[model samples]
Target: MPPVKIVTDSTADLPEELYQRFGISRVPLKVLIESQIYRDGIDITPDEFYTQLRQGKLASTSQPAPGEFASMFEELTKDGSSALCLTLSSQFSGTCQSARLAANMIKEKARVDVIDTRSATWGVGLMAIAACRALSQGKNHDEVKELVDSLILKMRISFLVDSLDYLERGGRIGKAQAFLGSLLSVKPLLSVKDGIVCPTQKVRGKNKGLERLVEIVEQEVGEAPIICAILAGADPEARDILHQKAKERLNCQEIWLGDVGPVIGSHVGPGACGIIYYSL
Candidate 1:
C-alpha cells in the first residue's frame, strides 16, 4: 500500500517551508476584505491582511466548499495513496464538515479520512506535523490516524488577543464574550477548550498577559518534554519574546514558529500571540 498523504486547511497557519518539507497539502479558506475575496495564505498573506485591518477595513472568512476538498483529495489519492486530513475545530468553523462531505464523495474511488482536530491555527498545524512524523516512522494510515486522535485530546492551546472587538464581530468570542466592553486596556487570555474558545484570564496589560501565558503552560506541563508551536499575528517581537520565555522555562523537545493567517487573524486581530503544545 502507498504511504498516507497528510492534508490540512490553511487555518493550520503552518509556515510554508514546513508544508514543503513534509509533503503536506492544504486547502484554502476564503477571506473577504473591502469587497474582494481572497484565499487565506494563497491570495493574501498575513502581513497584507493585517495591514488592511490596521487601516480600519473589516474582514470576514468562510470555509472552503466540499468540492474544493473533494478535488484535492481525488488528485492526491489518484495513485491509490490514502489521505489523512486534519482540520480546524468544528466549533470554530465548518471546515471540518466540508472535509467530511468530500471524504464521503470520494469514498469509493479513494480512501480519505477526515478528522476534526478540535483546534485551530498552529494547534491544527502541530497535529498535522505529528501525523507526518508518524508516517515517516512507517506507520500505516490507520495507525497515524489513531496517533493524531490522541494528540487532539492532549492538545493545550491558549492565546492573548489585543482586543475582543474582532472576536465579537466574528461571533467566535465564545465564553470570552464576557470580556467584551469592559476596559479598552484589558487584554483577554483565551484558550481552545473542547473545540471552542474559552476565557482563561483577563490581564490589565499586554506584558502581564504574556507572563501569564507562560505561567499557565508551566503549571500544566511543568518539566515534561513537549512539542510546541508558537503563533504570532503580525507581531514578531511578541512572538520572539514568548519563544524565548518558553525555551527558558519549559522542557520543549520540539518547537516551531508560525504566523496567524488571514482567516484566523480576521477574528483574533493583530498583536495576538500564543502557544500550543502537547507533552510527550
Candidate 2:
C-alpha cells in the first residue's frame, strides 16, 4: 500500500519549511482584519498579523468551508493514496467538523480519516510530524492512526499570554476569564486541558511566568526523552529564551521552533509564547 498522505489545517502552526519537507498538505483558516480576509499563513504571515494587532486592529478567524477540504481530499487521493487529516481541537474550532463533512462528501472517491487532535499550535503539528515519520518507516495507515491516538493522550500544551485582553476579546478565554481586570502585571499561565484552555497559575511578572512554564514541563517529564516545540506570536525574544531554557532543562531529543499563525494569534494575541511536547 502507498504511504498515507498527511493533512492538517493552518492552525497547527508548523514552521513553513516542514510542510514542504514532509509533503504535508495544509488547508488555511481565514483571518479577517478590517474588511479584508486573509488566509492564515497564505495571504498573511504571523509578523504581519501581529503588527496590525499592535496597531490596534481588530481581527477574527473562521474555519475553512467543507468544500475546500473536499477539493483537497479529491486531488490528493485521486491516484489511490489514502489521507490522514489531523485538526486542532473541536472544542476550539469547527475545522474538524468541516473536514469530516468533506470526508463524507468524497467517500466514493477515496478513504480519508479526519481526527480531532484535541490540540492546537505545535501540539497538532507534532502529531502530524510523528505520523509522517511513522509512515516513512513503513508503518501503514492503521499503525499510524494507533500511534497518533496514543500521542494525543501524552501531548501537553502550556503557555503564557502577555495579556488576557485578546483572549477575552475573542471569547476563547475559557477558565482564564477570571484573570481579567485583576492587575496589569499579573501573567496567567494556561494549559490546554482535554480540548479547552484552562488556567494553571498566575505569576506576577513575565520572567517568573517563563520560569514556571519550564518548571511545569520539567516536573511532568523529568529526564524522559521527548520531542518538543516552542511557539511564539510576534515575540521571538521570549520564544528564544524559552528555547534556551528548554535546552538547559529538559531531556529533549528533538525541538522545533515556530511562530503561532494568524488564527491562534488572533485569540492569544501578541507577546504569547508556549511549549508543546510529548514523551517519546
Candidate 3:
C-alpha cells in the first residue's frame, strides 16, 4: 500500500513547526490588501500581516483557486500515494469546495479523499492531527477518513473577540445595528456550530468575557481526556492571556498555542483572542 499523505489549507491555523513535524502539506489561500495579494505564510508572515493591520491597512482574503488545488492533488497522487485533503469549513470559505472539485478531476489510480472539517483554525488542525495519528498506526485511507469525520462531529469551538470591527469590515456581519446594542465596552463570546459562527453570550468587559469562555468550554465539554486547546491572535498580550488561562484550566495536557495565521487573523483582526478545542 502507498503511504498515506495528509493535506490541509493554511487556514487550519496550525503553527509552522507543527505542520513540518507532522509532514502535513498545506495549500495557502491569498490575502489581498488594496489589490495586492499575498499568500498566507508565504509573501506575508504573521508579524507582517499584523503590522499592516496596525498601520491602517484593511486586508481581505480569497480562497485558493480550483487550479491550485488541482495541481496539489495531481502532484501528491502522482507518486502512487493516496491523499486525504482537509479544508476549512465550507461555510467560512470556498477552499473546501475548491479542494473537492479538484479531487473529482483526479484520474490517477491513487485515491484522493476530501474532508470539509466544518470548523476553523485549531478545530480543523486537531482533526488533521487525529487523521495523521491514525494513518501512522497503519490505518488505511478509508479507515482514517472515517475516524476523522466522526471526530469532527464531536468537536466544539468557542472563542471571544475583543471587538466586532473585524467582522464588520469583512462583510461577514449581516447587520451592524445588531451589535450596536453591545458596542459599549462589551466583549462577545462566539461559537462555531455546524460550520457557521453564532453569538453565544456578551459580557460587560474583557475579563468577564475571558472567564465566560473558559466556563463555557469546561461546562460544555465536561472532562474529556482527548481534548486540545489553541490560543490564536496577532496581539502578544491577548495571545499570552489565552495561553496562560488555558494552561491553568486545561492543565497543559490539552493545550496548543498557535499563531493565528493570516487567513484566520484577517477575519478576526489584530488583538483578537480566542481558543478552539475538541470535546473529549
| lDDT of the candidates, in the order given | 0.92, 0.93, 0.79
Instruction: For candidate 3, give the lDDT.
Output: 0.79
Model 2 segments more than 4 A misplaced: none
Q: How close is candidate 2 to the true structure, as a TM-score?
A: 0.98
- Candidate RMSDs in order: 0.8, 0.8, 2.0
Model 1: how far is 280 from its true place, Å? 0.6
Cα deviation at 69, candidate 3, in Å, is 0.7
lDDT string for model 3 (1-280, tens) is 8888899998887777888888888899999987799989778888888888889988899999888988987887787898999999898888999998888888445578889998888888888888888988899999999998997888887777777788777765433326535766888778878887778877888777777777777776555554666565666676677667766776335677777778888877776677777655
lDDT of candidate 1 over 123-160, digit per residue (tens): 88988988998999899999999999999999999899
For candidate 2, write residues 1-280 as lDDT tens digits.
8758999999988767999999999999999999999999889988899999999999999999999999999999998999999999999999999999999999988999999999999999999999999999999999999999999999999999989888888888988777778588888899998888898989998889889999999999999999999988998989999999999999999999999899999999898999999998
Model 2 steric clash pairs: none
What lDDT score goes with residue 163 in model 2? 90
* Model 1 regions lying over 4 Å from their true place: none
